[model samples]
Target: MLTWAVRMRRTRQFAWLYATTWRVAIPGMIAFPRKPIGITAHGREVVVPSGLLKLLMKVVLGRATQVFAVSRYTRDVMRDRKVISPQTGVVNWNGLSGDAANWHIRSTSSDDNTQLFTICRLVPRKNVRGAIEAIALLRRQNRLGNCRYIIAGRGEDETALRNLVAQHNLEDVIQLVGYRTDEEVTAYFQSTDVFVHPQIVLKDGADFEGFGLVVAEAMSYGIPVIAGRDGGTADFVQNGQNGILVDGHAIPEIADAIEQLVQSPKRRNQLGSSGRHWVSENLSWSKHAKKILVGLSSA
Candidate 1:
């Protein structure tokens, strides 16, 4: 990358280096940043790049021409960590796949059961256990109807989550469907009635949702969302507009949010429709690119 930048500059050409992840941007931060460049765009993915990494980022990343964050939560956290200068960074919310808007808006299901879907690596910060606890709470209250919470993804936390399900006698209601294929993912999204991602900040706020793309995808599929209130998801999920935001550590609130949507298909469709429209208007690769390009040119 250093060689490429040098070569371009030697030929009287401008060099614009952009990395989509921290790993990809490290080399540039080490070799360039302070050097000559037309634009240097780096993404902020880590909640906290600790140790030497944290020190290096704090000192070097601010020297870059531009820094783009996937969400406001990510940008603000990095600022709080002193890893990036608040002035040099901009929040570029992740976009939905093209054609997300063209899908036919799904009608509310009249079936007796509702399908609640969640997809993410099984990690403590994801707070999958919180969702399970909410389900257990619902069951205890006899408010949980014929609903199924389908968790799709595999990671270190899976075993514990499964144990929690069994402990609550919720084995029949919760299923951890490990890693899904692209087709299977699409099918799950299509069939989903509500998307649940009660992610929380963990590891002393070192792990969090930078941007909740899956929530947006579910919304694009016309599925209502129920997300935790602690992360970038708040940027996209307006409490009652597009989705409901609940405290990740509170089981009662999560259960109440779930039960509310489960009982009202009309509410589900309303939130889902508004969410899809939000995605079509604000989230797209083109929109993301335009913002970056505009920022670069303006800067």
Candidate 2:
């Protein structure tokens, strides 16, 4: 509606359309001028065979001056779908909010308890259940000691997840703390030893993790992370460098990744420090905005 109003009144004064998803891009393409730039976060949405949406994307993407994708993975998908000309598509990674990145930096402790954290909606695609399962595997192996798993956020699969926790008898180890305030989330980052976002693409390939921003947020806080290799996370996590990337669906890999960090505080601190630098250099909001301006200039 707002875009339509802008079109009706400000025809001469065009605006850039930053599409958080393809759904938003659809209307933006229709209501905005072709000269203005467009941004999209994921590729699946553009490639989907929705009758009207596909047609709209094909029209706008083919003619747009340029389109920005949040990750190289997304850029590849757009090319594969022929949504945008390969030369016109650019990969501009998503940036971290200033408040989120600098809220609380974790202090290294040699003898402190390890806190495994993941803050995301309780959804199947998020693979929170996989995290829980990995923790359970650790418990069974007697490898987890003084380690607490914190899974925050609420969604439709909460009850089923709670059931999984109960089944594993991880009630004592896993805390399904539903939803948290911004302050609470910051506190978790500060106190957490390792952050894990084990996300996976669903069987039908309909849903998958996009740019794993929370992993970057955790990295910004100087916390080591274990993430999935499915999406844009690969763009940031340099596997065993800044953070560890694993196959989210593989239980052993997730458990092993956590164990590697937990058993060696020295390794954890090393990765955490490197991750902080990476976030500051590449994922900062200020840097992201500047990059967008540069992209616009070139366009």
- Predicted model with the maximum TM-score: 1
Q: Give the 10-residue window scoring lowest on summed lDDT in candidate 1.
A: 36-45
What residue pairs are clashing in model 2? none
* Candidate 1 Cα misplacement greater than 4 A, ranges: 1-15, 29-47, 103-110
lDDT of 2 by residue, 142-198 (tens): 987678888899999899999999999988888989989998888888889999998
How many residue pairs clash per model? 0, 0
User: Model 2 off-target regions past 4 Å?
Assistant: 7-34, 99-103, 108-111
Model 2 TM-score, 2 decimals: 0.89
Tens digits of per-residue lDDT, candidate 1, 213-262, equal 88888888778999999888999889999999999999899999999998
TM per candidate:
0.90, 0.89
**Candidate 1: which pairs clash?**
none
Error of 1 at 26 (Å): 4.0
Task: Give the local distance difference test score of model 2.
Answer: 0.79
Error of 1 at 226 (Å): 0.1
